[model samples]
Target: MESPPSVEIISSSFIKPKFISEEANKPVYLSPWDLAMMSTHYIQKGLLYALPKTQDFSITAFLDDLKHSLSDTLTHFYPLAARLSTVKQQNPPSFTMFIDPNNSPGARFIHSSVNLTIAGILTPTDVPITVQSFFDHHKAISHDGTKLSLLSVQVTELIDGIFIGCSVNHMVADGSSFWHFFNSWSEVFRSGTITRPPVTKRWVPPGPDPIITLPFASGDEVIERPNYPLGLRVRIFHFSSDSLAKLKAKVNSECNTSKISTLQALAALVWRCMTRARRLLPEQETTCGMAADNRKRLSPPLPETYFGTSLHSVKATTTAGKLLHHSNAWAAWRLHQSVVNHDDKVVQEFVNSWLEKPLVYTMSRYFDASCVHIGSSPRFDMYGNKFNLGNGLAVLSGYANKFDGKVTVYPGRESGGSMDLEICMLSKNMKAFESDEEFMSVVTY
Candidate 1:
């Protein structure tokens, strides 16, 4: 049998911000929402771009320019270069993030190379597990920010392409912020400036005590390495614009309502198909948890450039029998209601509950044979990150934070409202899901 691919480390170093300010060095208290993700894994994702075809194209020059732009980018996104510090001395430990200019704490940058082709990485029926090697901090969780770099980047030089992998502490940023930093880096790389600067001021709930204290006295008490299930397989399923429109039309027609959105219809289809593929008991309960972006949902919406985690998980649930027996529109309506109901009031209420008793997210929270958790919005501009090499051929999720029943949605490279669902599930279930006719019907890839 052929051995899996391997990555040879060419170089590894810390890339500090080009400039720092005393204000940027001040400790910024983590909000309750940020504290909630302390136990989760770092957000790991990367973009693959075909190498430019030009006699002047020089890999060495390209990499040097990329690193220089990243340094300049960090000047604006300095918080990413900071460390997560725990105030263990406090009665109940408090967390704060700050950059120590004197110590020169910086984002970890790794340069690596792999003897593989772009097709070898993207043509497989399943996402290559070897892709995990393209990222740093595979075993590190968000809380490890105390000792680990809050942000780590690995640029892997492929035979005909380049894969830029990024791992950001989940407690420090969400999908929105992740993409913001990525886009900013690309902008700086190509144009030497950004259109909109990131808002570094972290959001705090309006109350007597803005900073919510953790129940634990030390980071050790809260840090946990979740044991994900074994024998899992991940595959990307593509849904074209026409396919999405057809799905939305079918569900809305069946329900005689136009309220179900394309996302709702798509979620409903996955929820029902996975339930059938699992072959669960008829009466067993099934749940679909969707990560709702609360930036706009909150009253007096935060800036689009807000640089921190701002997400809430909303769930729609029903018995497996009911889910399978119901019309596609019925399931879509359930998901639609769950998402639309998460308004400002709900967001604030969840914050209040977290303040009363902080609860860090664990993989087990959503790990269940009967549960599906969907994250990463399809609305994110996955294909627009050019960085002078042109649009990405594909966007990939790393092995970190992966568990059975986890589904991450990304906009297709083809754009025009198309979407790609990166689904992770047990090997057995994946085999069944791949053979599922209804699910495969809309899948373009």
Candidate 2:
């Protein structure tokens, strides 16, 4: 590990909007299961880069200063950073929630800090500099500040570039919320003032209100047969423009099908592709878990100020053979049925009931169970138009972990009569997808 920069703090302050006032009304405690679910994803890192040579800021100091500056915003979302602070051992067991349960909630966000490291890059000039790695090296599995470290001194280099990696708990904030924090941090650093207001609406803790829970389970499948991976896998491929055009045209023109979104068509194709990869029989049901942003879809559009958690998941299934047999028309219709009006109560109930069952005993039993976790956000294209991260800079994207054979399908360019499809799958599945002439021809132009 490398040390952080030695930079002076100009001025740093959080922009807490009027909407977040209510969420601060009380400290919320998530179930140990929810915290564990959140912690698992923290292992999947989100990274971005910064190239600021003129500023007196060192990568190390910038991170240290930023961590101190953003303490207010950090405390506001205490559950995310602090909850993982109590870990005593490396990658502690599931039952051990990280943060000290008895610690005052006020101490929550304040404990969070930014760490740094240095990696060499190919460059013409000879400069030695360090980079900021926000995550704790020791607390790879937990979220403790001490486990988290700071480079004792400033780091400088010839390249004049730094990479910032964020390991925030997804349960605390999605990419959207995370971007808001980033933009605010940039604003405070650049101008020494919090110019823009908080992007999140006031937080509303879901009261004993009857509603859905996350990680919606279906069947006794997840529990009855927990499929642990026999080995790790990776694959990659580039979808050409021509191939995407032809596929969209075929799916759009399929009989008995009206206009179908590229997402649905791609989802079907991905399921088919995964089935092909596993060589599953058409009669066997395969599930692709889809992630949805319930923001606008939720009634009253869920408070803009309300932050906490604001998304949910839905699962759809079909026999591999049955899906394979379908013409574009039938598959599109089936895909539409699974996702359209997903906000409806019936769909929510369908997902929640499956997860509520006490299946710890069952979930522990299986390994190598096949599942495709799919998440695609239309917002990825919009460069912070609404969230307003400053300087016209935004990283508008999110994805499920490469584990569990995930697929993310979102809107693509309009080709022929349909929009282009962007499909991201685990590396291995991607290779299988690219080699499938049938799959490639239809989607490409």
Candidate 3:
């Protein structure tokens, strides 16, 4: 990433906004029905790299400039500064809140230091190994506010390679919204003003009245825990377009189906892989859930411009006997039906139930479950544009999902004419699928 020229910060007119208070705003209670989707752990972060155009590039200079521009832009987004709050004992409704540093809603922390290392520059490395890391590495979940570590700035070059790594927090934004924010940020830096305004449409989380009955009793009912280490492994698979087409053809032929998006196909393929991985002694079934953004499904479709946490979830389950022997197309067709039926109310209802559950209780159920999976759409324009920082553009966001012992799928490169799909599963699951010649053929294709 090319560093920007230094500019004077004379006559600063910066003023940070304060988070909303219970005294000022009404407390919205969570219901039990909202729990299905809300019980999972949610942590998002991103690593954006500005690939180099020329071998000659400077890291320190580029990051210093990016920080200046970013800080200025973030000053306008107040949610980053706000803290989380829930209703206390419901009489007239009072908020029970603990302003934890990690849970703060608004711009909680900024990158405090910069760490840089270059690897595989002159080596026989075939692909760029973007080893992006985060700051405030050690964060403990606390009820009370605690000072947290911040990644003030990070800029690194890989030996003779050209790329700068940038990572950011999830509370600030999701992948799609953050990408929009970054595009605007880049536009502002280049044009001195954003060409497009941010999406400001309000997302009505499950309404406050009727007290959405969540599945759980209270927040105390849901359990939250860090993901198990080494239990899950992450890998990226790129399929040749021809192979993708052949697989799609096979799926269509086997299922007597029409064109199905690669995502739906992969979901079916993954479900089969995981269920078959169990090497079961008896027939069993498991649920597979997909994260659907209902921003466009509301009575009034949510503003594409509206920014906030706007998402709904849908789940599908397959009996071990059915998935184990089902043709790829058959499972894919069933999976597609389940996802299409997921709507805003379903999502909101799930969230309500999630919020009402005791954290511990929810966590335990999640950990004990044999089948659970959730992932987002790869709909954003990530690898399309080249962001030139006198070097190259890099992608960034907060989806550090370690799919521990679960089946997960996200968007990948295009397969056929549809969006390509990225599928992740536990290592054991991967091995199991690979062991099945037929299953492996379906996936590898």
Candidate 4:
């Protein structure tokens, strides 16, 4: 086996936004979700983009541009450049939040170059795809309750392309907030200004609503982290348009009811296959959890461009044998129904359910082996965010998923109807998972 590509940091600097006023340093209160997220130093979300060739933008020139644009963009998105911590008090505090000060620490930006190319690594060949090796691994997930830089950008120059990886703290922003900053930064990179200004203030509950609380005592956190360290494996699975359609049609037929979305069908298929691989009991309760974006779904809706975590998670649960024994459609319908249940009334109820209590969520925190999480929506332009590079986006992957049974979905590299599944599982489960004939039948790559 060959070693994966390595990243050598050429230059590391702190880029403080040019516009942060003294008042911008005022302590910022954290949302309930923020506190819950801080409990486990869950690995930061990573994005690897292979940029097209550029004649004018040399590796140095590109890094120069990235640094300047990112700094400018962070001005409007200042909280990103701020630190995630609690107000220091002699008596200790109940909640942790962002520490703000004029000279507070800024995001860490590293300029790196790798002796690899997008073609060599991304395209499968003799060696298996060890994508996690080519990313900013340690700085992203190594949290010991100190040094809370909200964002870290590592721009590596590859032989034939540019490898851009972002390690963003979940408490800093969820998918919505992360993408909002990304889009604005891209706009600043290409157009010198952003179109949609950010709405950084958080959304609060209605009048008379009780204050929400969350447990955040680090080591004693209720996070569903692995009880013991286990070696993990990462693999990329592809689903072609034709195969997805056929599976969707078959699912709808078996469901014997109204149609469900392709995502639901896909989730059900993967969940069932994984459940069968685990060989859980017929009565064992297994869950499939997916997050719902509440940008526009919640009452009154969030701002036109809310730059914070606004995700509401919903799960479909069933007995292991019950889910496995039924037709794929039955499982698909369960997934769809879970999403359907995230209605306006349920959205409010979700908030109320966490009042004066811990804000528990299912993502990387599902403690048991019976849980399977459906990650990053396929609807997200994961691979389509163009940097205005000539050849455009060639591929996209979240590269650093460490949790077992967690799958992150992305758009296929080639185009329409194609999908990429990055499945992270323990070595044992992953070994058995790859050989599962039922899953291999529909996979295109």
Candidate 4 on 1-445: residue-level lDDT in tens? 6777666778888888878766566655555555556443434444455555455656667778888999999888888787655433333334444535445568878778778766676566222343443344342432322464677777767777666667776765776677677778888988889888788776657655333334444423454433323575666788998888888888888777656988889888889999888878999999888877777778777785887677766799999989988878888998898888787788777666665566544334454688888777666555544555543443444344346777777777665777878787777777677788878888997
Best candidate, TM-score-wise? 1
What is the Cα-based lDDT of residue 161 in candidate 1?
91
Alpha-carbon lDDT of model 1: 0.87
Per-residue lDDT, model 1, residue 392, is 92
lDDT of each residue in 1-445, candidate 2, tens digit only = 5453432322322222122344444334433223323332332222223355355755556555555545544434433333333222233222222232123232211112223222332221212222222232312322222233211111122233333334455444554555555555455545545544443333333457322233322211222222323343432222454554555566778743556765666666766766676667667877766666655655557544344445555566678787677765566566666667676474346335534542221222221235566654534432222111122211212222334455443233222233323343344555665678666555443
Global lDDT scores for all candidate models: 0.87, 0.41, 0.45, 0.68
Q: How close is candidate 3 to the true structure, as a TM-score?
A: 0.69
TM-score, per-candidate, Cα-based: 0.96, 0.60, 0.69, 0.86
Candidate 3 residue lDDT tens string, 1-445: 7432221211212222333433323322222322232333333333334345565755555554555555555544433333434435555433333222234333433322222322332122111223323322222222111232112223333333333233333322444565566566565555546555555323434454534332333444443544544544444444455655677677777777676666667667766666667564336767666667666766667677654445544667767787777687887777778777776566556555545552322334543335656565656654432335432222322223444444333334342333333334556665665577655564443
Alpha-carbon runs more than 4 Å astray in model 1: 90-104
Give the deviation of candidate 4 from the true structure as CA RMSD: 3.5
Q: What is the lDDT of residue 191 in candidate 2?
A: 59
Separate clash counts for every candidate: 0, 45, 65, 0
RMSD of each: 1.6, 9.3, 7.5, 3.5
TM-score, prediction 4:
0.86
lDDT of model 3 at position 292: 70
